[model samples]
Target: MPAPNAWVLTEGHAGMESQAVGLAEALGLTPEPRRLRARLPWDWLPGRLWPVPLMGVTTEQGPLAPPWPGVAISCGNVSAPVCAALRRRGVKAVHVQHPKMDPAAFDAVVAAVHDGITGPNVIVTRNALHRATPERLAAARAEWMPRFAHLPRPLVAVLVGGTNGRFRLDGEVGADVAERLAGMMERDKVGLYVTPSRRTGEDAKRALADRLVPLGAEIWDMQGENPYFGLLACADAIVVTCDSVSMMSEAVASSVPVFILDLPGKSRRIGEFIDMLVRDGRVRRFDGRLETWPVTPLDDTPAAAAEVKRRLGL
Candidate 1:
């Protein structure tokens, strides 16, 4: 018999993995994260085209043998096949993003509206799921407060995402961001908490530091401990780069106001998501102004998880 709980499938990307884990937690399930490993052309194949046996994994990776699980939450295109394989064994699969195949393959397909995936089973979410909750936020605040307390009040946390296919965080854009932020620091007298994503190359990182550090902003040197969660918990306002939906979702999910910084290119899905938040008054574009306003946090994880439970009858 399969396990009585839920399993989260991923290829090990942090953002994608977090969504699966987030949804699982919202469902009140302890997520058993399973990383999928494959090789060759088979590895590149879409879930629908994947062979029965799949690909390779070390013995230490655990037995994928029988008894998959009661429910499986999968993120990313590669993990779709793992979910599909489990579906063959009576596992209900909740897939995030366009499965890059038939929507009918899964019990429920959760996608962002911009993905243009529609079906009877498809549920659209304004943003990607995340593990931002009141409890987590409280813990983060408690743990991170004393460390950041010395910084001034009205903290502005800047979450910088690197480049995606549509847009790149090149030196030019980085300079523009630095200049704008320097202006904000000079005029607003607010302290900054800055952290760069992996996609944020050294050039962009240096650019931001050169401008923000001297102004008394606390920028993570990518060493020791990361203050990401603490910053989110403690920030009075948040500024996020537009290339990532996950970052924006986490920001707006906090009670603080979110300022979205526009990148050079465009992403239909990300754009639509941001527009929705803007209309809802949860977010605004960064215009060299740091403003704090009250609005309900944008939370979709719980509802999405509830839908999964109802559909799976768990």
Candidate 2:
């Protein structure tokens, strides 16, 4: 059972929530997730610079009142001040990702190596924290294996991400990606399962679905429970779009061979991260081939959690 003694703070963003929840679970804490929203001018300003942190936080669920937890795991710059405020009140606060401010404010700042931020209080990791535990994988495998039994062996999981500030995955690009993945499935006789993020625009998903689904690929249309964990558990190879560091981090953290699908536009920072993995032989670029290779997972969730424990003596 998870201990209910921690709070996972975010601005209600999926990526931020995942990282914060991942850390809290790693700490054996069943956290109360709170989304901090700042109204008016406060929302436009930097959370790190807030004079009164609590003043900026308001939750639709309830007011940001007291009875705070012993631990606060925060992600997202918007909600960072709330974590700092909790820390000042004697709660141990840990921030995931770069806080975009001084790292010394939190008990520990969990950052990625690519971010290039470092301090005594910083815990640098090769990948982002996620909620992909071994036990969860085992359970997913047990639950989903039967459902996917008819799909055949060598199942490939394709994670499709859409447009972001840096990259674009429009219909044309989506078709191109779909064509390549479909080629892999047809050529390799692999069962292809594709999942798209909310960022995956409808047109992009349609493009992918139109092409890949006809080739016996299973693409989740964002209905029912997200089969993401199931795909992770059952995949022999994982192909993920390069728009998100968090998504790539989760895939790269797995022992399965990972293939990075390229998108339009250049993101040099994320490119550097991909290059690091490529140099290490842990990942390769997707080019219509289902090539297999030995992969040793490079996970940092436990390490970050351990740092939290070490810092807070929890």
TM-score of each: 0.92, 0.96
Off-target runs (Cα >4 Å) in candidate 1 are: 1-5, 56-63
The C-alpha RMSD in Å for every predicted model, in order, reads 2.6, 1.4
**lDDT (0-100) at residue 287 of candidate 1?**
97
Quote the RMSD, in angstroms, for model 2. 1.4
Give the Cα lDDT of each candidate.
0.83, 0.87
lDDT of 1 by residue, 1-314 (tens): 54357888887777888888888888877788888776565656555676673443212366476556788888887788778767877888889888888878789988877778999998888778899988999999999999988898788999999887988898878989999988888899888889897779888888888888888987898898878889889988899999888888889889888999998998877888889889888999999988877888888888887887898787
Single out the weakest 10-residue window by summed lDDT for candidate 1.
53-62
Write model 2 residue lDDT over 43-136, tens digit each, in one string.
Answer: 7778877888888778877767778788898898877778888888988989998888777778999988998889999999888889888888
Against the correct fold, how does model 1 do in TM-score? Answer: 0.92
Residue pairs that clash (backbone atoms under 3 angstroms), model 2:
none
Give the total clashing residue pairs for model 2.
Answer: 0
